[model samples]
Target: MANPTNFPDLQVPGGRMHDDQELCEHLLRSLDRPALLEILPSKIDLGGTGLFAKEVIPEGTEVFRSIPLLNCIGHEMSEFMCDYCHTSLTNGIDAAGHLRIAGDALPTISRCTQCGVCSYCSKDCQRKAWRKYHKLECPVLGQHPHASAEARALYRLIAMVKQDSLSEQEWRALAYLKAHEEQWSGHLEDLMYYQPQVDNPHRSTPLAFAVAARSAVRGAETLMQPGIDNLQLYGLYFRILTNDMDVAGPLHPNIGRTVDLVGSLMNHSCDPNTFAFFEGRQLRVRSLKPIQAGEEITVSYVDAREGFMMRHDVLWFKYFIDCKCNRCEEEELRISTLMSQESSSFEDFYQAEKELIDIRNEVSRDYKAFRSEDGINQVKTAISTVVSQIFRTQPWPDTLLPMCHMKQILAELSFKLNTNPNQIAIYTLQSCFGITQRSGPHWVYALHSLATHLTPMTAALNRLKNTPPLLLLLALIMRLLAPPAPPATPPDCPATPRQFWDFYNGLLYELVLQSRKTYGTDSACAVALVEKYARARARSSWLGPEERPLPGERGFAERFGEAQVAMLG
Candidate 1:
């Protein structure tokens, strides 16, 4: 365990330094974020902390950009990514479920020769990683090559502490996070005695914790300044699980998990004002909506697009938090109102609620058991079952949340199968609708982008079934996907078999405009969108008609109205 007596500057958690607003400022200063944000006691979480905006923060303003304090790539993805810089080794798999060949222009990833366990994109990154913490870790990882990503992350954190690689401020920030040791220990005991199957795979049992901790200690203990016991290690593990964020990027959505000082301090909300996005391994949080001065800066820990019940249950089970956010309160009232209006009797409502929950469980079980090698028919059957069981229930509107949850799984399965673009579009569209109806269009734009890909000018445009709805959806998606400002100079257009320059111009142009609003005109997202717009413009200049949408597709309002009618059916 860390000894505060050795370092007089470091105060224990729950001490005056942690509770005092003045001393906390010094800790927040270490983050070097915008002065517009401050750490404050949260009204939302009783006796918990939160981040607040010190000044009015406009939409699209960059709140902060953080390089991870600690991060690790998942074991399954270690082969594909550089363990040092977290860069992709290959172009990754294409839409057809085949691995895409990396072009000669890209840098090649190389494995470390000593241990052959970690990979690096360049020699510089390799040396830097070794100097940072990998000098001690490589041997351990080499011996236990099959260690889980979480265990590896914890091991790396411990190695950093032993080597004094982290600054005093960084160490203090991490130690300040709550471990929930008592609550988690009780939960583990309950799981051991009562449950045969683990509800969450990431959760640790007493036996598993002992084995992981012993293995880590055996390899790294020799190097420690102040050694830690199993109890202290278990406490750290609980803290890691509670505060970690999924490290996702544009290229790879599920790369790994990371924990950082500033990012973890932000609390969860069902309807958050800010959203985090990534550029390589660096995380940048931007305001989704304008935030007023003194307002709490919150982000959704779970996907806000998810139905209320799913969000509520996950929060309660994992964080031990019963969310009483405004959104949850409204949703609760809405559900009650809906039940009273739609239900013929209390008994009917109970039966419908029971049926909905049962269907969710059944889908969840089968979905987990499903493997890529399995037939697509099983997934299709699950989708059908969810729809038939819940979509026509007595209070079907109340069941939309679970219905959407099931559709989310179906959309993911469709993407994995990579067999039918049409199915992908349909499932993605349904999934997006479920989100847009509740959270708003911004949350569902990524899903909509998947569907929009099917309607590219080069695709078989005439073969599309719901042309108006599809076209409208594509237009809306492109509009949302675009950044604010376009490039000053158009990029050269690449040759295609058949060029629909007009469609390309409209789609890419919308993407550029939307990007400017969502991300700043100078942001990486906006810059990338501008480059794409340039190519479309270069092509449209000579090869096609004036910038126009597909034939007979109306403006957004009309299209949205038509789409709503079509979607409800």
Candidate 2:
């Protein structure tokens, strides 16, 4: 049968699809409610689909939210994180596997009494999980407490499919997502070598598929779901490989994965206007910039802040699409032209870029390497290496996106280490400059980090007083960072008669407002920032009454630019 969505038939191995044709048809049907955004052929690619705004979407506006069709905590994190809300329960845990919050600081989390695994943040989450698939999964999970995360997640999907647990609208929404099965079609053989138990590993298979197959087979036996076949199981696996999103929030202690049928409708762009954040089980998509009517709503499939080559590599290998976003196209052209013009410049960039990539690859291969004390020193070394190579060219080209990406990583590492606050501010500011000179998601989050880092302004100000360059750069950026109009009433700080503290309070207030727009009000980051502003403002009030400004701070402005440049070095 012809595919209803009219994308190519799923590239199932041996061209065999056991009883999946109905699903192919089902995916094309409409959802129960009218979609918030229009689904249409993408202007970026022919025969591809994308989501578009139906009306003007102001920056910080929430475009849509959806509960995951399925969710699972990562295997590494399943022990400490709530299986339902994905909250961390580490602090509350005791030896007996019973955990409760004192003073109701947070909802209490408890391990499943029967399974002694899969903690839930509240009884409500437990009941929701039970009704969804936990009732079928709990007994199986009890017997095999060590099932891989993918197995646990896929088992739920298979059981739900067999029992018709999914709402029809959900099944329809999922059908709309097309899988890149061809990417996995070539990995079947390698799968069986690693995992012999899978009845029929495809002729081409990778170890990842083998691991997934091993989990699926074990789960099948444990669940005893009738009619669950190899092709059916593999079909679900490929969909997850293609469409699953990381369940992440600024407050999340560890990342997990989930499949949100409607959330999967948006396509990838290296310059996406919308970003997704998770609140408990709900996924919310919000605009990062003002999106006018008819504008296509896009989200980055990979980290958009990465250099072009890295972004391209991920897009091609994982999603099987070549990004043609304007930023990607321009960066690609600029790099090629720069190489043709100056071979030495290109060679220098290439060598430095390769080193950074190697460091990243090493960290990915062994995450522990980036977390150890030794890893901290290695990152310090990497930062020095990039900084040295960066100034080699006169006025480093902004197109060297990798340099910015390197700075971003260095900043994150610095923040994680929490050893040197000065370095964190410098690296983060440098990274933000490399991408865009404007306020954006990067700026919002970076400022949030700084504000959060420097809270209780008295001590922080005293600590950073010696670093005038840092303060000066922050003031300049935050001034430039202000939106055309304030999102809310400015906290009682006046523009004239401004003390540096006035600007500082303004910065904190603007950051709190912008963060709420960018990350939704319910976001943990936004909430904390708001409270921090209130306390900071109150403290400023107690300091003293404001006086009219005295002028005549000569030559400070001229020295500002020069000092900043020297400080950057």
Candidate 3:
């Protein structure tokens, strides 16, 4: 559906307007509609504040999906190019005939074996090269002395072009280069001039080169489509390839498109709602929280914990903009010594909160002893104590502790369970479940806490089903504790999962009526028990078939039997 102009306006919780309509319109147009809507706030208040819904949405809802406005595949798809051969080091191949993987040693240019325009280590490399576009351009290279460089330059050119739909001028440029191989050399020169150059005596063609470069640059500028960013960084790398011919790179197939869309929209925030996951080719956006309709959707440009100065520096380099988010505003407020002193009093008190510290230390020690002995009982005791403390503390649970302290406790427990998935892990998990159940049937943390414990417990259960009874007990506990299906409504909004649970239970009650039509009331009771146990805890007060209906009570089977038969028929 097309984006509606009348969608609710979103503002900060306390009636803050981050941007006006003109800015919002510009931002929305810049983003793909689906991506924009994924982060948009649900409703806007007249005061221009955005408040998120308070319900928890299911985990795998399709938030936003989109095809890139521009798509590009790297040249490696066309040829077997070595590090020394490819212009983009980020997408370079190595001597082993493999795409150079990132975060590894840089491949040496000297190892490159020239097969034609492209270089490889051996025949296997040549074959790999041929599978790529190399075969298409290989023959033409032999026709021109500068074919290798020309092909490399053209590959880089085509790679960048893939990110956007080519305009008529770009289309004509591509066709012309394809028709006349020498034209690639002229285009390469134009790209080089677009980047800043340092003085070098060995550089070819002094005055004529300068004149040709200036003319080509001006000509290229005229041909370029409007609205495209200058992309000076990519241009700089292009210039480097022209100067230093030996640089090799990684096989970043998605670099072109990633830079085109996500890279273009990159913004910084110390706290961000949008997170990106790269799934091979496409970049996916997940909402960490419910975003309001008109709010500017933002992603963390760097790790969140970095101090303001460091984070700001990184964002400036990437997005070329200064961040002025709430966190930064907090940092600015902290700079005043008077304000800092006042804030520090509460911060110190919170930091030194004795009850939190004692529980944390106890949990930590219990974890260590359990790990050393591989003792399930010890782990169980520790987990139980932690969960007890979590609930006793009211709203702020143990899971919401300060990062360092929370990580420490989680790490210790995680280590014991991860290293040894025995009875101890089950007990530790059951303790979490016990706390969740005790907390309340409808507690929000109940499902999340159970899921955290069960994820590992499930794997262990699969491996140790035939082991001890205690282990099996733990597994069953974990299974029973599995998080309820994600809440039907968004988390920050007013709706609660309990409402949805009631609706779902109503559906199950109806299903029981259908079962009675096929099997009779006695069988219907059994089905009800089974379904109820699967979805929720069994209650002692639940009626059985032998029991007569009370004054105002209706048996589920008797009340809905006719409807069930009609549905079946």
Candidate 4:
């Protein structure tokens, strides 16, 4: 018989934090974020801890915000992206509006001396990064540039804690967070595939590389630190596995990752009251619904749109727990309903969906026709037709909307075929009609689809310089179906990300007027449209208008800077 894996102790060095005082205040104080959230320990098996709402909070209200404890850009994409801000450093334009491609005079990214691959946006960014654990990590990365994401995340945490030399209180708080060392030990061989190079200066097992990185800072002190030593490093590895959050950017939603201290207390739920978004290093949590006092404040650990079985499999594999959330319990599990189900309005939607997928796959295989589209008639028409048919029936706030697949195909298709901007505008209007007709007054699927579609739809309409009845109606529908701003920060800022937030929010107020016009004042659809906005790294098809850039026209990175500068002025 195989022996059981030896797991570390669950209790902290001292369990003094069993009292509620050491929750979030000290951790958030540095970021100037208020200690609005609190943690309560649980006796439940899957529920080690849970965060509770302090007061009756309204929808879209900012609840709590905190900076991540450890963060790093993805190893592969570390170059051509700012390590600090995560802005794309791909292309640049001079003050004279002249284009500069790769290897320009003013190089956008500065390569790290120790690790040749590590790149930063500016000197300020590089300096800020040095103070925040990079000083310890430089040598380890230089030795082997291909360290796994998990190892790097752990290395970042170890470096930060050792440099700051964590207080006992901080260590206690960290220990209170969950780790799956026992469960992880089962996959130990799979985990060790990406160890530090054999002859590397930090010449130890992957776990001890963190300690060796700390060697240069202080000799005996590195060995003496009790909070994150070699044993703790093993346990800390699993802690990171359990609690790390995706570090998304303005352009690319997920470019990196970070570990949250206080946010770890917010447990997983299929139906959650709270949502979180990134603002630089800070993580802002907001209420997605009217959370009552003493109610559990939770965020979705996985995309809720995933089918019950798919969601179950994901949660079970990643989290090692079976979800019994209300949604999970309520859903009637069936294969067809999850994947190829038939709605009332369209029995053949799935067939069309299959065609789109096949075309997308074929296009993907083609090295020439990567389908990142701005305005293509064939691509837009096919997508609109297929999407309209899919939601023809049961469109009222349907979570089963094929959002991910639609977004993927719409962004990447071979537009080598004939494309008419006029046809795209027409197809857009057709889809909008289908959106309203199928979804009716209070259909969230239609709203999200239309709002996302508006980027491309509006792009086509703008090219025509004409607002027909259909185009005008599309505008009204957009006003009725836009994303909103967080209650606290009203999103008027120089950053393109925030500007996009404001642009979306400005359309939200008119929802009542348009809703009333379409569905009458008393109907659910006619009432005000209320939605929580988390400055989500969402890709709105309408946000970026695409056509082949003019010879002097800005590229993606240049255009982002252009848009932000335009907003600033």
What candidate 3 gets wrong by more than 4 Å, as runs, is: 1-64, 67-257, 286-294, 304-310, 316-322, 327-569
Q: Report the C-alpha lDDT of model 1 over 298-388, residue by residue, as the tens digit.
A: 8877655555665665676656777788778887776666656654443454444445556555555565455353645665564465445
lDDT of 4 at 531: 25
For candidate 4, the C-alpha RMSD (Å) to the true structure equals 14.5
Scanning candidate 4 in windows of ten residues, the lowest lDDT window is: 528-537
TM-score, predicted candidate 2 vs. hidden true structure: 0.69
Q: Write the per-residue lDDT of candidate 4 for residues 325-380, one digit (tens) a residue.
A: 77677653332453344443222533554555555445444525543343344555
The C-alpha stretches of model 1 lying farther than 4 A from their native spots are: 1-23, 89-104, 111-118, 143-148, 188-226, 251-253, 332-374, 391-422, 437-448, 455-507, 537-569
Q: Sort every candidate by lDDT, greatest first.
A: 2, 1, 4, 3
lDDT of each: 0.58, 0.60, 0.35, 0.49
- What does the lDDT come to for candidate 2? 0.60
RMSD of each: 8.8, 9.3, 19.8, 14.5
TM-score of 1: 0.72
Give the Å shift of residue 542 in candidate 3: 24
Off by over 4 Å in 2: 1-36, 41-45, 75-81, 87-107, 110-117, 138-152, 162-164, 189-226, 250-254, 337-375, 382-421, 432-440, 460-500, 520-527, 546-569
TM for every model, in the order presented, reads 0.72, 0.69, 0.32, 0.58
Greater lDDT among 1 and 2 belongs to: 2
